[model samples]
Target: MRKEAQELYRAEKDKIVLRPFTAKYPKIAPEESYRIQLALIEMKKADGAKVVGKKIGLTSKAMQKMLNVDQPDYGHILDNMVLPDAAVFLAGELIQPKIEPEIAFILDRELTGPGVTPTQVLAATRFVLPALEIIDSRIEGWKIKLCDTIADNASSARVVLGNSPKRVEEFDLKLIGMVLEKNGDIVQTGAGGAVLGHPAVAVAWLANAVGQFGVSLGAGEIVMPGALCAATDVSAGDLLQASFDGLGTVSVRFA
Candidate 1:
């Protein structure tokens, strides 16, 4: 990253308390965008936030093609970004909130390095749970290039994990289906295959990418393996539900 670009990135990140950035700075390349993201992560760490785990984005082939990226991208999810079940999220805190259904893996062992396989991810995982990711684009309307989204923490906002956890061997995850319901009506449907052929593959991609940054997936960290379906716009008073076959269901009500 150029010195001027780095300075601008840091300035924008430090000004988070004022208001999130709703537009992108022009001429930022993909690599430079990741540099800004890492810098922001460092800034957050300096402010006392603990890195919880990573989030994989654009795991779906459609999303990958739409974003014109061949592979997935990841972002750091801070501990403070997690919300427990039944918790309320102030609508005003987010810029443009969209919801996605995903499968979250809680690791029982640390995973690092490239060439990690999907089988390895399944073995390292303690359990898998249904998750609803509230993705708030600091960039307005969630409209931005791949680099813009990456710099914005893959549009991460808050993640809600379901109570029940299913063992990896207990279900046929590759064929698992997910139904997304809004206000009691099904809005979208998808399957684990929608996420880079399988959710575990997404985890593998995330593990490798994090390794490149000199980070490793730690035990007990929650890794969200991207969304199984396209994001749905959310509104206050709305009820969102995601049900995964055999794994279980997770729901949240907007206030």
Candidate 2:
């Protein structure tokens, strides 16, 4: 697992793609895959990367259908992965990148669970904000399975967050609408209900999912509840924006 983690870490640093781990180890269980992810995360931390929070992936019907996966995957969010809104990014920084919109939860209290609830999540959350998640697969050709993606940090790459922050009481997250635009054209639209019925439910699911690994959602951490729609391909010179009703908008540019 350490060797596999090393290869993945090197692949990210060198900007190279490799065969999916599942192709090599067909019997790898999801539990073992998460161990590999944790190993890779430890390597990054050794190199000065700080774990900022966590993220849930494949929680939306669109993403699940696109990935052919039925369950959600969890991944750690490194401090470096967080980016400012409206920032310009170099296209070459990642391999086979795609973008998706999410509702981000900024936590004020630690959450641990086997039985975490959405209400508990809201209680611990300090702010709810609009966010864009940039997903990049290290697996060659973006071929991945549940275990493969789990081992690859749920295909996580960069995260761009809007400046607008709202309290949980200020809005109905489950009914909020989101519109995604690429190159000045609307490409996708979805509601918060698309994410496991509600964004907080996704966060609650994450809290319980990672609890088996003895990991807890920490205070002051920014947790992204999963994309509200399917991922969109990105390339050089592409400009993307996502606007959420009542939550303001966030945009990014690829250079």
Candidate 3:
């Protein structure tokens, strides 16, 4: 089941894949599914892919309700999955992509959690950067359960980072606001508090959670806290921008 899922993920890329894991592997434990994810990440590393950072997903209560999950999930971001701020994303290069406005934490120090706190997260954070997470599901029609998505690396695909990062001491993150726009019109608006009351809270959760799996989020690694607002679909010729009130802005052109 693990091997087949990995094959389908690689072959489908951004396209709809046939036969989800749950349909064949009924009653599979979420922990087992996460083990599959870890295996997949190891395979990527073997293939010369570098682990750029980690992302927390379904942290928002809204998204948790949508996905019918009580807890959040984490995924790896490969070196090639990151793009510069304002870069173009070829629509043809991805399967049914969706964009979410998020703030990224650049860690200045290592953190291993079974007890990581939000305050410790902020202290370890080097700065905050505006970000847009591009998520794509390999399953057909985005149909997935928690185990399915977890095995599929939490449905992560690409991330865009603002070139400039603000120091942690420079601002109060809870008050950070973001305006998400498509084609120059605001489509969604939210603040840092929308994500588990604060983005650092989400990051803290990720540290402690992933730590149980023997994964330590290292220093200088970028951590993508959950999206501030709901995700919006993307298509060819679409221009999307996420502007944080004080942090800065990042844009992606879909072509």
Better of 1 and 3 by TM-score: 3
Tens-place lDDT per residue, model 3, 60-175, is 77677766778788888899899999998898877768998899998999889899999999999888899999998776667778887888788888999998889878887888
What range of 10 consecutive residues in model 1 has the weakest lDDT sum? 15-24
Q: What tens-digit string does per-residue lDDT give for candidate 1 at 1-255?
A: 444335434444443322223233566676777776777777777779899988999898766765566667788789888887656676666656788999999999999968789999999999998899998665544456677677767768789889999899998788999999999999999999999888998899888877777878999999999988888889788889999999889988888
lDDT of 2 by residue, 1-255 (tens): 999899999999999998989889999999899989999999999999999999899999899889889999999999999999999999899999999999999999999988999999999999999999999999998888899899999999999999999999999999999999999999999999999999999999999987876879999999999988999999999999999999999999999
Ranked by TM-score, the better of candidates 2 and 3 is: 2
Compared to the true structure, candidate 3 yields what TM-score? 0.95
Off by over 4 Å in 1: 1-27, 65-70
Task: Tell me which residue pairs clash in candidate 1.
Answer: none
TM accuracy, model 2 = 0.98
Ranking by TM-score: 2, 3, 1
Q: Please give the distance, in angstroms, between residue 69's alpha carbon in candidate 2 and its true position after superposition.
A: 0.8
Tell me how many clashing residue pairs each candidate has. Answer: 0, 0, 1
The lDDT values for all models are 0.80, 0.94, 0.86
Clash pairs for candidate 2 = none
